[model samples]
Target: MTLTKKILLGMFLGIIVGIFLNLVTPQAYPTIETYILSPVGKIFISLIKLLVVPIVIVSIILGTAGISDPKKLGRIGTKTIVFFLTTTAIALTLAIGLATLFQPGVGNFQLEGAQFEGKEAPPIVDTLLNIVPTNPFEAMTEGNMLQVIFFSILVGFAISQLQGRVKLVVDFLDQANDILMFLVGVIMKLAPYGAFALIAVAIGGQGIDAILAMAKYFGIVLLALFAHLVITYGSAVAMFGKTNPITFIKNFSPALAVAFSTSSSSATLPVSMDVAQKKLNIPKSISGFVQPLGATINMDGTAIMQGVATIFIAQVYAVDLSMGDLLTVVLTATLASIGTAGVPGVGLIMLSMVLTSIGLPVEAIGLILGVDRLLDMTRTAVNITGDATCALMIAKGEERHAESYSEAIAES
Candidate 1:
């Protein structure tokens, strides 16, 4: 069977086993999770995590080195930011609109004694300042992704400008990237097993009871995710990338399956990059540059959850959000996304920030925490799809731009 087919089967079996464990054999869950699911899933994720930082550094270096032109680099950077911001805004709009229309928060929910300790978000100015790495090695060691990205881009830019003087260094990075890519290929053989173990644990640990309790809220988040995926991403792939939407999703399925199981965009980077190039036919340069950056900042899926959660929380408290309050949620979440990059448990932190902006109770975050794990897994799948969609469009635009330039030169 093909890899996608295998991974799909794994996911199918995982859901079945997870529900079985949760509903049928609850007592055995602890043993099964501790002995089997945890080890196997961790091993697979560890293998992927092992490659993420090195691959990000080398691939971004090569991507920047390939561009070499400062003007073009600036253009790509601008385009990427625009796409991320625009799509993120659209995601929030869709989420809030759906929540409002569906009235998922209409049911009776307990409001008191809901306690949650939310991590505080950093000041925007400080977050921006911290992006520049003081010590590149320390940044790499800590897995400080924004700093690492800044350092890598600088190194890549310098290598491009120095040209022949750094030929040896450029070649070294090239070979290193190749080796890492090879490692990714070998590691992915374990993906089916990993997918099965991870999903089963997630579903079993949460149990069916918790999910059914907040069924309306959970269903709204899933519906918003599906709508965004099919409507937002599908339209972008077809209209801008000039590719069939179904084909784009099909080619990118391997990465999607892994992202769903892992729930970590950073961990899924290597696979997504590989799938983008080999499967989606995106050039290595664009895939390398865009996907790494997108993994850090592009957060449409998380944004969707926050949007829905904000509205859900408001309804649970019987406080109607004014027009201005809804707008506040959008602005706060969108800007907070950039500020909170690399923060642990970032989705919750950003939700806290959004809640504060609208004067909602922060402790109310606890209400949705039970089902958040399942939502997290689904939203992650949407998150990476946004990255690939942007890469495909950028790749297409770059191609057309190059063709136009060549035609002008021929005419001249």
Candidate 2:
């Protein structure tokens, strides 16, 4: 079997194994998880994370330097940001519409017992201000994505300016990118084992009771995620990327599976980049530039979750949200996608921000906390899919523009 099939099998087996452990060997599950499951999973995640900072900085620099023209760089940047924000808004719209139609929160839920201490979200200006790193080395050391992006782009810009003089630096970056991509290929060999262990841990630890208790909420979240994946991504790939959506999904499934298992957009970066370049035929320049940026800011999946969960919480609390409140949820979550990027536990943090924006109790987060892990896996898959889709569209546009320029030159 191919590697993707192997990874898929591992995930399937993980589900079966996880359910078995959860139901039959509940006693031994902890010991099993503490040693075997957690270690293997952490190793996989650590292996992926080990490559993230270097790959992002290197790839972004190369991508920006390849564009060479500052005008093209700025144009691509505008496209990336606009695509991310627009899709985020669509995600919220789908999520809220579905939640309203379904009324998943129309059941009895206790508010007093909800026990979540939400982290305070930083101001948007601070997130923007800190984008330019104080110390670029410190940013890289801390894995600060915003600062790293800022420094890398500036370096790429400088390299592009002194292209002939800095040929050696560009060459070094090319070799470094090659090395990182090779390491990604080698690390992916461990994926099936890693996927199996990590998913087993997620499913096993999340008891069946919590899943059953929150079945409606869980189902609603999944439905919204499914809608976003099918509607938003499928349409983007078909219309904007100018490719069959099924082909896109088939080619991209390996990364999707990994994202589902790992639940980290940053961790899935190397795999997604490789898949984009080789499988989806996106050029390295676009893949590197768009995806790392997308990973940080393009959070359609998380935005969908926040939208549905906010409405769900409001309905459960018997608070009728006006048309204005729904609009606020959409606006708040869409902006929060970028503003809350790089924050730890950001999914929940963003959700809390959405809750606060509309006068919902932040502690209401505890109500859906039970099923968040499982939903997280699925939404994360959606999240990376969004990033890849945006990259595909941008790459396609660049391809067409190049072709048009060639044709115009021939005519002239």
Whole-structure CA lDDT of model 1? 0.93
Cα shift from native, residue 194, model 2 (Å): 0.8
Give TM per candidate.
0.98, 0.98
Q: How many pairs of residues collide in model 1?
A: 0
**Prediction-by-prediction clash tally:** 0, 0
lDDT tens digits by residue: candidate 2, 1-412: 8889989999999889899999999999999999999999999999999999999999999998899988889988999999999999999999999899999899888778898999998898889988998899999999999999989999988998999999999999999999999999999999999999988998899989889988988998899899888888899899989999999999999999899999999999999999989999998899999999989988888888898899899999888999998888888888889898999999999999888888998988999988899999999899999999999999899888889989999999
Q: Each candidate: what lDDT?
A: 0.93, 0.92
lDDT (Cα) of model 2: 0.92
Model 2 TM-score? Answer: 0.98
Cα lDDT of model 1 by residue, 136-160, tens digit:
9999999999999999899889988
What value does the lDDT take at residue 108 in candidate 2? 80
